[model samples]
Target: MRLNSLVKPLLITGFMLAGTAQAAPDAREVLEASPVDDIVAQYPEMMSRGIQDGLKQSGQVPPMVADSIGFLVSNSFRAADIEQRVVANLEAALTPEQLEEVHGWYQTPVAGKIAEAEIAASAPAAWPEIRSRAEDLNKRYQGTAREKLFDRFDAASRATESAVDTTIAVQLGLGTAMAALSRDSVHHEKMRERLESQRPALRGMVGQQVYDGYLFTYRDISNQEMNLYLDFLESEAGRSFTRVVTNSVQQAVIEPVESIGARLAAFGNFGGE
Candidate 1:
């Protein structure tokens, strides 16, 4: 399946409904407004203001609201959709206790904190690796095939990031709810052990196999766009753009989201009810 085909309807719906007074903001809007605000508020140095049309920062005028909304919608929708598929895959491969253990990893304060810290520590290292890998792969392939591969990787990465972040949020937000369901240290520990025992199977749910599929599909249609981006990155113009996008996304986007997630988790209380 082409990424465009998968994303077009979502983009259209988001664009048509942007800023309309619907009964409840669609998931994308709620995501855009709340999380973006939370992010800005968390980092006063990076972001002097919140989402105004787009994400405003101290030095930079934000991107157009439509563009930011589209990016958020495409990334968010893809992530949520793919994660549901992952959950379905895990449901078939793992037991209930195992699944709850996976959930527990997200629910526990230490685990959640560790995961966030790891991602932050790893991102600087990871991006260069991703770029290098993509470049090498492109060199081995030619023409449309190469383009498709890059696009697929980019889309999958975005989706994966969104999915992971949302999972963290859900886990943290509903820690209280989950505690109400599970009681006693023995029970919780047992569930954790079951999940740990099934680690291979659970990892498969978010592993390279599924991610490769997402990348392959994206590359099929967006090869040209991917090539253009790569070329720019290889040039001065692209270098600047890359720095801005990377920095803004990390400082303005990821940091705030993780902070809010931590706060929500703290508010929920780590213990299961």
Candidate 2:
């Protein structure tokens, strides 16, 4: 399949929506209003390409074939119905009062600027500057005030774990499909075990990605703008926002991704049968 064909179906498949909407200011409103899609539409595609190249490096697939397949699979995943599914997954997790508070925060000038920065950071063109800024920021973050910033950033974003979790899950899915095509003696359980074992190694890379992402995203943001964000994230309102997002993702994205890997493995099993 081509890139154009795969995007919507991929999202729908990834999330498996049932078209049911709940109350207002729910997960639906939260996801759409958040920088979720901007983040989603870009990163998974990049990861898929990396997975494809990595498979080629391991002699599991030819580079040309891997590129075509990876492109097809990743492009289709530009969040096919994912937002709706995420919205659907929330079940009054955020009280109306909390929702209102979070909504007000999102409307703030600082939030808008930060959102723009985050979305832009996902772009391929942003990598060089992002990396450079992250390096500089890491060096600068040794003192008390700056150490506090990294702590707040980690708490708000959960960037390292989120990145690692997401990468491993999607890589497993793509790896399963690749092993099938290459006729490798693949045991899904064993593959998962190996990947799980590599967590320590993967953490640093994912952490770095998240770190650069933060620096790049907030590169030109003013200290006041930064503090506004830091305050919100550290506040109860921020905690609620993060909780609901984590909950919705667990329901809509994470669980469904596990299903995708299983289904791909099942497909290989059926082929053997």
Candidate 3:
């Protein structure tokens, strides 16, 4: 064998090895590259805020009871646990090729900017601004092309559906807590049936709220970039990513609340009142 021939073969082998080494990222690495983890990391705080707000709106629960329930519910949904569940779901729900594509998209500049907007909107501080501007936003964008785009994006991303799911989950949690306080049994089936019957009305209400939120969050995002985002959301990997993240977060939020009643009941006399 000639020395030149051997050298050429060695070079080709090296290139092949390098290519193989650059394989698709694992679940955690994919998560790190995306904003999913950051968004999910805020779930516990969001859940807590929702519980407090719901209690306040009802204006029925005593402050001490409300506070105790809030503490118990908040402590139950840790960011770590939610993140772990999200990663696991991603690994299970997505194929290797889909995961690779999903990871690649999240690393793009457009994805980064979109993620920044989402994270900002998810923050506790952003709620006031979002609420204050929602009316003006709706008035300005209600019939525009951008609104249409937002509507499409919401449909592709199932934003309204996710909001509805989260709302129902919170309602179930509150019901469990109330039942516990009253020393009554919580029939989850009946509760779910009732909520299901109300789903249409809830969907209409949440859909509008979701639209308003999109207007506020993506106000600065150009239509071109949003179109790019919509493309991703409509893609196979994008769909898988949405399903995995939505399911994981819902499970994390919903599962913890099942025990909220028992936990609250442990407060004994205070829970009774």
Candidate 4:
């Protein structure tokens, strides 16, 4: 799929709703009250160490949750602006026939089933063993190895965030194209009318799917990576590498792989013609 096409729904709806008069929710409070706390609570290493705030994980003084929330909201808004153009182009290129396919793809039982299956398959069978190994490695390395590995994980996570932002930006561009390609004023009006008519249902469906997909991707990827990481943490050399190299490679190489894959897919479709 084109990058813009993948991002349109995520960026567009958020933008369209930006003008609403409702008071914006507090990002920090929301983050604190969110599943973030639950996840943090469940983190064996961090939780055991009383490091629920991410700052301590990196050996930094934890900032107020409000401050982190502010940063997150600012970043989100800025990213949305950059994504608008991508969405425009995406919408422009979406033929009616293609739109049907997109809708069908999202709605299919196959998509959800496959996603779930992949997630299940990605989970490690022995989380306790993995954790034990990590703990032993941490003891042997005096925590240095574990710290290094975590740094790498953080870097990779940031890179993933960047890719998602870029994808959304491309989608916004596509949306602009779509808006322009729309026929006469009447035709545009009709499209708007139709969108308005379907707004509630479309928003509910899209929002739920996007949120669920995000959670699934996050969990599956994290679990898969953690399994390998724990194994490494248990080994002396693996611990050293995690401390020195894991995060760097994840950020520098692994994260960009998706975007590169997307680019290659586009090129393949064009066939060098």
Score each candidate by Cα lDDT: 0.38, 0.67, 0.83, 0.36
Residue 209 lDDT in model 1? Answer: 31
lDDT of 1 by residue, 127-230 (tens): 34544455454455546465445454444234344434433333332232233323322343454455457556544454443344333323333455444434
Tens digits of lDDT, candidate 4, 167-190: 333323222223333321234346
lDDT of 3 by residue, 1-273 (tens): 889999999999999999888887888988888887888878777777778777878875877767777787778888888889888989998998989998899889999999999999988678889989999999998778898897689878889999898888778667766766666665767877888899999999989888878999999999899999999999989998888888888888888876775455555437466
Q: Lowest lDDT 10-mer window, candidate 1?
A: 45-54
List where candidate 4 sits over 4 angstroms from the true fold. Answer: 1-56, 65-89, 114-273
Among these predictions, the greatest TM-score belongs to 3
TM-score for predicted model 1 compared with the true structure: 0.26
- How many backbone overlaps does candidate 3 show? 0
Q: Which 10 residues in a row give candidate 4 its minimum summed lDDT?
A: 43-52
Comparing 2 with 3 on TM-score, the higher-scoring candidate is: 3
> Tens digit of lDDT per residue, candidate 2, span 1-273?
789798989788656544333333655566667787676667456555555666687776678866765665565453645555555544356666777677778877788889888888777666667766777777765463544566578878666777687677766776776577556877777888999999999998787777657655775787667888888887876786776665555444445445555655567767887
Higher-lDDT candidate among 3 and 4? 3
Which runs of model 2 end up more than 4 angstroms from their true locations? 1-27, 41-47, 53-60, 75-80, 132-144, 250-273
Model 2 vs. true fold: TM: 0.73
